[model samples]
Structure formats: structure tokens, C-alpha cells
Target: AKYRINAFHELSERASQTYTTKQMTMEGVGEASRLGSKIINCKDVSYFWEGGCLLKEFSYNFQRFDKVEIVGRNGVGKSTFLDLLTGVLQPSSGVIERGESLVIGYYRQEGMDFTGDDTVLDIVGDTRLLGRFLFPHDMLNTRVSRLSGGEKRRLYLLTILMKNPNLLILDEPTNDLDIVTLNILEEYLKEYGGSLIIVSHDRHFLDRVVDHLLVFCGEGIVKDFIGSFSEYRSYMRDYESAKKKDSIASIKPQSSAKPEKKAEDKPRKLSFNQKRELESIESRLPELEEKKAAIEKDMNSGALPYDKLKEAAELFKQVSNEIDELETRWLELQN
Candidate 1:
């Protein structure tokens, strides 16, 4: 966060000769690419360190068109395995084998290497493509050092795509990106003709970008499940809920299993007014959610300007707050 300070040079720099031309295309991404027409397999992969092993026996058969997303609670070594896949870290015991043609474009969560004082135009030679990416003509002469944090991240993405890698690995890419940019990135990922491996907590983005998940269970175990992030969350919720119900049922008839509620603490029957309010909330919450989804659909198009996007995002936030309040109240009434 501290390193993203902007300190670009002004109009004194030469703008014409500094810029070069590069184009993004998917033409040559054939079987020759590292992400060729096959899967990159991890066979019983495990990573060890001085203190302890980070991951154990993780295996996944990742293939092109897989659009895999990895999910787990923090400190589960999601990033560690990404490093192993990228060859940055080695597994103590298992194997991570890449396809014959694998060109990986990795975007880490933070701290990208900025080699030198390359201007915005210098980094991306063609001004038109830069413009498409929201870099203005005047800003083209600005140094990469002068760009804002979000601007720098967007530029980093540009550089990555310019490499035309067939395998894309993006780790927590939505962290600093605004909603507008996130939506745009989602669209790009949808149309990208490459294999994708993303590690993110943004459920909306994951649902749109990834087709399945690699869930990390603790103690170095990883489970490969076929579904979107939302689907996985729903599954986990159901599992936890069922487990809780089973636990409650197991001890239900035991005399000393649990203390009974005091007479005054018993749940009261809903009053007429409370019942009316509950029904109203149940109806209103769906409307609010539907409105939020519509706003999200428009924002995802990335057609709004910064100011308009912020306005729409604020409205979306308000809708979300309303839904949350209504749901909370509804639960209270039910109790």
C-alpha cells in the first residue's frame, strides 16, 4: 500500500518516440502453448518448510477451459500452492507437472515489481489500447510512478495480457479494483480463450468467471468440487446446518444434556402487527435484492464513468443495507 505513491514526470517528456505498438490476440494459442490442449496435473503434491509442512498431498487435474477457482479460509496455503504451480515454490514430496505448452500470466495480490521509471505510454506503446484501458491521452506522458494505486493495478493487468499467455493465474485480483473495473475484468475473463486459475473471495466474480473450485480442507487436504463459488458456499452452509441439526437431535432427550429455557425466556407467539411486518419484509427483501442484481448487471458492463459508477455503487450499497436490515428483522420476528 505504501509503495503505490504517484510521482510521474509532467509534459517535459517526449511522448512520440517513447511509445511502442503491441496488440492482444488469441491466434497463436495452439497446442504449442504451455497451456496447450491438456491438463496440468498435480499428483499428491505437498510442500514443507523449516517449521512445518505448508500443504500436503494436494492433487488437482486442471485443464484448459476448466476455469478453476480456489477457495479456503485464510492461512490455508491457497497462495502457497499457487506458488508451487507457478514454479516459485517446490513441493517436498509430490509432483506438479505442467502441460507441454504452458504460458502462465500470474497476478499476485500485492507488491508487483516495477523495474524502472517507464512512462505509461512507454509501458504500453499503443495509445489506442491504453485509451481503451481508461488511460487518457494526456496521462500517456505520465510516468508509471505517477499513476494511482488502482491505475497501476490496471496497467499491470495490461502488461500481463500483452504477453498473450495461455494460462492465467490471478490471486485476489478484486481486492483494490473498483466495482466498475471488477465488472469489466469479469467480462474479459468470460471471453478469454485461455485456461484460468483464480484465487479470490469475491463470490460474484467467482460465479461469473470460474466453473468449479479447488477447496482446501485443513491439514494439507484439497478437495476438487465442480461448481461456482456460490454453489460451494451453499453446499457448505447445508452441510454445517445438517451437522448442527444432527448434534441437536443426538442430545435432545438426554436429561442432563442441556439446560431448559426459563419460562419467561420461551419464544413468544408473533403478534398480529409483527406478523404483518414479517410478511412485508419477506416481500420487500426480494424486491431489494432484485434491484441490487439489476444495478450489478449494469455496473458489470463497465460502461459507466468513474463518478456514475460510484453513484450506482452507492445505490447498490443502500439496497444491500436495506435487505440486510429486513432479513435481520424477519429473523427476530420468527424467533
Candidate 2:
């Protein structure tokens, strides 16, 4: 009788434990369904510009994801879409639904302003939780007025992070960030558990961080693709090729209305200063490439100590900035 009673008690305990686990799982799923689904929902969304349609019947469902990237050419309403989602701008006509527990941290392309008299340290320190990934220093006393544009960008990122948000909406997050900070931010996002939606022109960064892509094309149409930037490009190329072939096959042969226009090619010309700038950029490119190669070598060989690696990484960032600046100047000269 004693043995039978003990067996019965063990079964009862097991049953109770299973019931508790099931209940907890059900509660978690309920919460996720309520809070993580449909982070940004738009149906028949439209926005108009002067005598033109910026967005026409754009619609998509952006749910919680590890990372999402928004891509498009300039003036395609990418920023406007973000603004509409964040309530910065009201849509002309559409319904947008945000989850109840969704808290958003937005980083705009332009700089953000902190309270006057706030020191860099104070601004950064106040956002320690978010800043820790990038700053990792006690900067509470550093005055914002003294901070550089890059520093300000970092601080803004930290401020958004400090809010402990469920969703992160970054607009051109890489615009002014140093390469080191950008890499650090990438690492953090890779490990972050919450949802992320970002707009960036940095192709490499998008390739590394985002698992999904949202493209805003003119005419109020948003395209969704479930892959990285490279994948999206590949898909786009294939689609265009197929479309071209189909069009060619469907066209009926007809006489040309006017003389066939010959494709004209012209020799490119550059001014003296422009040529010099291009030369300067070209000269610097190899040096940066060499430095990058050296860092990779050191990392591969395990010859760099932790401190040395960190220093090298910082130098790499500086070089990258110099390269970008030079390239930008060169492009302007070409234009």
C-alpha cells in the first residue's frame, strides 16, 4: 500500500509540472501574437507629391524580424514611408496599425538635438544601455557642443537604445558613423533579440545585417523580398531579364515610323582639378586596401593581441572614412 501511494504521488507531480509548462508556453505565444505581429501594417497606402504620385497604393505587413532593410533610389519616398510609420507624417489615405507593446527607437539621417547645456558625457551616459555597445566609456561630462558630427550620431543611437525599445527604426544609420562604430553596431544588431527595420545605402552593411528587404518603388508600390541585399539584386536581375525577353517575344514586327536612331557614344572629359581629385582618390585606394589586408592577415595569424587588434580596428575605421570622403569628392569632380 505504501509503495502504491508513493507511485501515485510521483505521477501527480509530473502531471502538475507538465500543466505548468504548457500554461507558460501558451501565455508566451499569446503575448507574442499580440505584440510582435504586424509591427507596421499598411493597406492601400498612398502619398502624392506636386503633380506626381510619390506612393500609390503601397501596402505591406512588417512583422517582428531579426532584421529588415528598406532600400530604394533617392526621392522614392523611403524616408517618407518611415515618417508615416513613425507618425512624423500623416498618410494622405491609408490605415497603419502598430502593435500595442511596440516601442520604437528611431535614428534619422540628420542630427538630433539634445537639451541645451547637456554635455556629451551626460547625453551619452543617459543612454548608457544603448551607448555601451558603441561608446563603452563614461562620457557623462563631455559636452554635446564639443562633440563631432560622428559623435552626435553615436549619441543619438545610444539615446534610442536607452529606451529599451521593442523595435528599432534606423534611417540611414550609417550616414555619419565611423566604420568602427558601424561595425560595432552591426555586431550588436546581430545579437539583439528585438525587431529591427533600417534604411541604409551601405550595400555591404545591408548585406551583412538584414535578412529581409523592403523596397519602395515610385507609384506607391512597396516590394517585399525574403533575403539579403545580394539576393535581392540577383532576383531583380533575373526578373528584368525575363521581362525583357517576354516583351521582345511578344512584339509584332513593324516598320519603324522614323529613321532608327543610332546609339551615340561620346568621349568623357574632366577638368584639371577634377582629374587631380580622381588621381588623389585612386592613389589612396590602394593604401586603404593594403591596410585592410594587413589587418586581415594579423587576425588570421593570431599575431595581434587584443589591445593591438582594437587599435588596428580603430585605424581601419579612420582609413575607411578617408576613403569615403575621397571617393565622394572624386564623384563630385566627375559630375
Among the numbered candidates, top TM-score falls to 1
TM-scores for all candidates: the values are 0.67, 0.64
> Candidate 2 at 35: error in angstroms?
3.6
lDDT per residue, candidate 2, 89-132, as tens digits? 88788777787777887888764877757876666545445355
Candidate 1 C-alpha lDDT tens digits along 78-190: 89888999998888998888877778888886646564588887887766557766788888888878778888888887777767678888988876676667766877777
Candidate 2 worst ten-residue window by lDDT = 1-10
lDDT of each structure?
0.67, 0.63
For every candidate in turn, the CA RMSD to the true structure comes to 14.9, 15.7
- Output the number of the lDDT-best candidate: 1
Clashes of each: 8, 11
Cα deviation of 171 in candidate 1 (Å)? 0.8
List the candidate 2 regions with Cα displacement exceeding 4 Å: 1-38, 126-131, 134-138, 244-335
Q: What is the alpha-carbon lDDT of model 1 when measured against the actual structure?
A: 0.67
Count backbone overlaps in model 1.
8
Query: What's the CA error at residue 197 for candidate 1, in Å?
Result: 0.7
